[model samples]
Target: MTITRRFPATLLALTLATPWSAWADRVYSDAQLHYVNFVQETDGMDALFRAMDEGNIHDVAIMGLGVAKKWEESAPKAPRYYMGDEAPVYYYSATDALLADAILERPAAQQARLHPFIAGFNPTDMNAVNHIRLMLDMHPGLWKGIGEILTRHDDLTALTKGETARANHPALMKVYELAAAENLPVILHSNITSKRERAPIYLEELVEAVGKNPDTTFIWAHAGTSAEIHRYQERVSGLHDIVSTLLAEHDNLYIDLSWTVLEPYLLDEGEPDEEWVALVKAYPGRFMIGSDLVGRFDSLASTIRSFDAFLNALPEDVADGVARTNMLALLPE
Candidate 1:
């Protein structure tokens, strides 16, 4: 049976307002946190550490944005965001190095808290596998995982100005093979369906990726949901059924409870959803929390604290596992 409760607004507000790191009560390890923005700029190491301190986040699965939103010559004004202009977004390969450099700049203790994952490669490119190998060789011990590998993203797919990346792409297969060989976890973002499609058009592709590579630990980002997807359809009716079925079948698969998956699924109107609480409690080790905050520090505490309501509803041990240990357990020793 699933336990349910509405999180007290006053308690939540107080938790968000206070800094927990100093109290040594830092209870979270963000399973997914972006270190850089679309343009490859970060909140700076100092600011990031400060935010981490404030949020009581002990560790992070940090990575850079895979695609860079370009400023086209035709556009007179500079676009601040990816959606700000009509300029095409392209694969930015240097992102891995930028992330590596930032981590390297920090003190050894601070550096250990940031687990760098490589993004910034085109999943459709055949050479992408080689790039992954190269990053591992170059950094030696820095990389913990591979991805936010973009595949069948909503507007980003059309704006990407190249071949669409499907989860079952041959190039990505090789990448998965490499990750398996390296014993690294992969975080892939492949939308289950397009914005307007009622049926899950792209579900097969993701299933294919997971089924074919049983050795690879794959974290399906947001359980195949996106902000735009929810905007078009309030919810994917079959999401719960689909996820339960997949988890039962695939032991290597994990679901990332990023920002997108929180609403209309995990939490119902700010209270913990009983069904989702049951789903998570059923597979305690497979569900992990993530902020998915990109290049921002101000909201890190609030963003992570958002998971509290849902986490608090689960058994204490299960709640602790999802919030702290699950993602870190996936990383290399």
Candidate 2:
């Protein structure tokens, strides 16, 4: 049976109240987003499409939540979010089916602009690659990419009720092999380091994965940053240097300028960072923008537009690519 929980009232209100036309005057493209939350719930595709049209988002790379936040008995009430309490979250393998069904239910016109990715398996399980293979076989033309795979996510990692996931996990390497064979790009959420770490301690794992999977396209989500990392103000020191070096070394690796990566790295207090600008200019094809919104469509436009300052800082062509075309280019024909 499919399980679901009610979205928090405050979040629902905020999502619905934000005017879609808030950015009607400016259209932006998103490279990473989720149509469902941790509990596998959304406001339906109708609302999402309306938001997309009104928000002027012409294309998007969307996926389902890989982990489902469980409402444990000890947590007096149900948790509305992944971090709502000490409740444990687990891999929801059925999420890929749900995502595929939702997209198949949509009209072809609507589906055209929506690039769906497979993301509902345990990355550490040896059988995880089997699940991915099965999903691909089950829905041959539906899946455009792989992942949003959770790895080394600080709070989520601690709360997750299973083996720890890492980019360099044996199972994930196999999955990468399959992705390369299938010509599907992979989006991975492996943090560069833990919150308190001063250096990019976990960088080697990601580097190893990217290095080994030369043929598999890997889009490092948030450029290896996360909300909790940003919230605690414990972002890895020398992140810019780390990212620059990775881009310089990895030809198959790409970075998404998601909401979490926008501040500090790409922009500081709404001002563009010259270092990041130089990096993007140096490798314009490897960068793209995303809202990182999960199950909330109202803020999609504003969140994507948040990158406007950094995008504006780039040359016109480079800005256009980061704002739109670059992500589309990643979709395999």
Candidate 3:
């Protein structure tokens, strides 16, 4: 399992190893479409899981749970839909919900479906819920009268941010250690509702808190795609940490351009920013290619086309990383 010194440098080796067609002058063909999925909602969770089990999708991350839930809950007479989706869940449904649904699912019933494992809960919500749960001395899905836990699965998120339940804190270091132990990469969905809210408290503090745990991976989702052409150009142009954290974090850390892929913003050279390409050149391997806010498998091609338009507009060195290799590095081979 030892990685050899054949790599001249971490960055350079990554650039060379990527496929050549990705760097061609014209846009990459619709065929590379094979590697991408435009996941919009969670309605087709069972079908997708079946697809994955059947090897129909091997390249995508289990990242888009909102899409699934929304589609399912909104769909006509959707069989297994959860009622009135209103949880501050982290990424997808929690590990417990997923297991519970599967074990209870009837072979032909929709009750068997589930979103992604990580619930992508807001850090604020995560902190808040942990606080309330501590006060109630309860876990998710606690019954009112019987005090029963709904699922049989053990709660991995049993640790608190600090010694006390109500302490204003982050479990950054703990997240790092657990990710390392479990060999699961970490994804932080920053670039939230506003650009200015992107600050010391959320992930940078979390990153500083975790410091360095070599095995852990941290991804800053969205990469401020909302920072349109002007803000990126005239105002907050020098924000390398936006780009740097993507580069400087642990080996498994990554950035996935989900919401950002749809942005119409641009610079004079028709680039998002020169730094995006430069960042890719700087750290190609530490990225995971994704396009969020999509609908169905049929709808993915359109999303891919949009993602390609943004990618093709970028300098070859940068777009290649975001489009491919960065995520491939994490394939659990």
Candidate 4:
């Protein structure tokens, strides 16, 4: 028998209420929470810790420094022009030393258990690979994995002067090899298509990367879409099919359910979709949730709240795995 669960109306109402402390207590107080997609910022470590404390988010996989001012300045601005007046330009300062410094700055008791992802925009360059290795050497026990590597990212590529490095590019493959040797997973963002169409156009590159490096685990960030992309494009019906196929074929692949990218497909009228439910049940161990909060401390509570229903619909063990355990298993011991 297929069991279904729904988020209660009262809980939903409470989740939207301000002074998020109340919502946090109601939903997350007793839950063992671990957020997998925290983007590191030059500032805001203190505030991030404060929010994490309130939400009971104990551990985080923080991506590298996000502000690449030089690349942002040199890249074309056409892609973001459509974003309108309030479209803020995003920046990253994701370096190993900076991330280490940020974590160390936090008081010992307040610091969320940290798992760092070394960020790389262009992994095709040998220098980038060398830099990653050097970072690992310098910060002996700091890094847990490699990436949120902007592979096949259309918006970021435009902003970084059109550096369209695919997931299986030689340089990235070498990095994957290094990660495998070190027993670390690599999180990557490779969108399914550049056009607004619902097609898995560049999936082969991602598949090849996974196939060639069977030893290294790969976490597909946002299941290949972001809130911004979802806003502009029609929902892609084929996404679930692609994900299902990949999960069955690749033992090493995992999906990061982050932000609002997969919301429509995961839910119908605020309830879990039967098809999505079955898909998750079939591959229970392969999916994890992430806030994908890019240095926005205040958004943590709301981001976890957004996925409340989807997580609730899963089988109990599966929900727990996605909520905390799977990510914990992937982190460096």
Candidate 5:
């Protein structure tokens, strides 16, 4: 029962007529749409699709549980510090099980392009491993990957009494082992350090996980970005060297070049960093771009377009790989 929505004629005509730079042309097309990392709600799928259509993105790896509750009802109960009175916040519970069901229930055409990742939240929860196994058992083919699994997440850890999940915890190791056995990629969001000093305190857990599980492919979400880290800290010095070292050491590791978090490291004074360019060229297949859009669709095009400069700086083949090809390659066969 999949439905394939054809691109609108006007959009198609525009896509063909626009003389985008050679790099831009390589990243998008009618037959080939850029892949995105999606955090979508069940009620908002149509809007997401529309946004994707507008952005010329046909495929998405849906992350999180997909917006379970309304923001007002789910807002933090404590009187937390606030910088702005009107800062936007969303509260939703998206489980991997729910996301898998949503994708499976889509029309056949849509299902073909939507890949769902299983969620394994709360490593301390005794049932976390069993819960993930149950979901995988129930829907054998519905999910293609695992995570945006929260490890050392500041906001989430705050909600859980400051108990940060560790990548190599016994419970998480079980889950990672399962992912490897299933041949599915695992997307992990493990911040490198808890403090704003860019000390790389908690990075060893990630390195250990990758080193231990050579069979499993791990996509380091946001390339170890933390919004809270950025808000308090100055730029992380030698970030590129650290990342390049990780890539060189681990064949199983990949980076999610999502928005805002990676913007600083990728560019230097609004220009592409030559060192970053060389690193990417050396391992062209190791990067993928994601809008990291949650529940909202308006910024879709702008987010994807933001990477144009970064993409333009790379060799055509490597740029294409980062922009779209690598994501497709990671999908379940």
Candidate 6:
């Protein structure tokens, strides 16, 4: 559900008080549109609570993997390496920096509304350079208020060298290190793409790195993807030799059903019920439910319905694990 379209925003970097506060702003044109008011809408963490009440699924805790205010721009361009291009504004600058500034500058409730739940960020679309550049180029036209903010702020380019190899690797490691220190479960993104040739292999190396860190509890995205399965067999003959922390790497790691394109393209559409049930059971405490919800691109109902469909396919015990048990184990009491 990684919609490749976007509206532009301020590209100025702010001198952040904390690294996470590097820069922050509203993701949507109308602040009310974003899913920030989960509690206001339904009383608690809205979706999880609803799922529990309806018996659609429950017991799992949710941690959003990526949270950016909006696309730097959407001109249908993609990064050559999916991981290389983060939303443009995440770069660096000082003058116009807000969110951190705004959080400090504004009231507490207003700031809390801006922060997203999860620590790590993932942009699953491919064709990074143009996909990102086109949007940046278009910023002036679409979101001028943000453009004004950028005008007043400093513009910073990527300090990380070799964005694909070293840059992404380092950023990921930094986040993992923080999460591990907090003893929080780390959802190492397994965001996969069939069309991108070497994307999966490069990403696999990073996942292996996280697996090597014992303090970090890793969750693989998309069940390691078909490419991961094929490559592990064809290339390494399934050794996974790059150093890992978890003893049962495959079983200990988790992957959510979100981040996939279509039902059939993923696993089995016809007998998905049995297949998903078996797969969830096979993972044990490791697997947890994730939506990778692309609200700007898709309808919330459709996204939830898809989760519902996956739940319907699972055996009751397996569904219970995915919907509740696995998530509960990952999150703190």
Question: lDDT tens string, model 5, 70-116?
Answer: 22344555222222122232322345645555566667767765667
Q: How do the residues 1-333 of candidate 6 rate in per-residue lDDT, one tens digit apiece?
A: 111112112211121111211224101111011222111111223442343334332212222212222233663563322233454433222211221232234343332222222322222223322322333243222111110000001011121222332213544555445545545554443333223343344445545555556565555544434333344332222222221223245434544444342244223553344434554555544554544432222343344345545555665555545544454344422
Q: Give the per-residue lDDT digits (tens) of candidate 2, residues 1-333.
A: 121211245753453333323434545668988989988888778888888877678788999999999988777888889989888899998888888888888766677778889999999999999998899788777788998888999999999987899999999999999999999999999998888775778899999999999999999998888877777764657888888899989999999889788887898778998999999999988999988778878887678777888888887667777887678777876
Clashes of each: 0, 0, 14, 10, 10, 21
Stronger candidate by lDDT (2 vs 5): 2
Cα lDDT, all candidates: 0.87, 0.84, 0.37, 0.66, 0.66, 0.34
Candidate 1 has what TM-score?
A: 0.92
Worst 10 residues of 3 by lDDT: 145-154
Model 1 stretches astray by more than 4 angstroms:
1-26
User: Which candidate should be chosen as best, given TM-score against the real structure?
Assistant: 1
TM-score of each: 0.92, 0.91, 0.51, 0.80, 0.80, 0.47
Highest lDDT, which number? 1
Candidate 4 — which residues are off by over 4 angstroms?
1-43, 65-67, 70-94, 109-112
Residues forming the 10-long window of minimal summed lDDT in candidate 1: 1-10
Error of 4 at 249 (Å): 0.4
Give the candidates in order of lDDT, highest first: 1, 2, 5, 4, 3, 6
Better of 3 and 5 by TM-score: 5
Give the C-alpha lDDT of model 1: 0.87
> What shift in Å separates residue 19 of candidate 6 from its native position after superposition?
40
Query: How many clashing residue pairs are found in candidate 1?
Result: 0
lDDT of 4 by residue, 270-306 (tens): 8988888899899887887777665556767666667
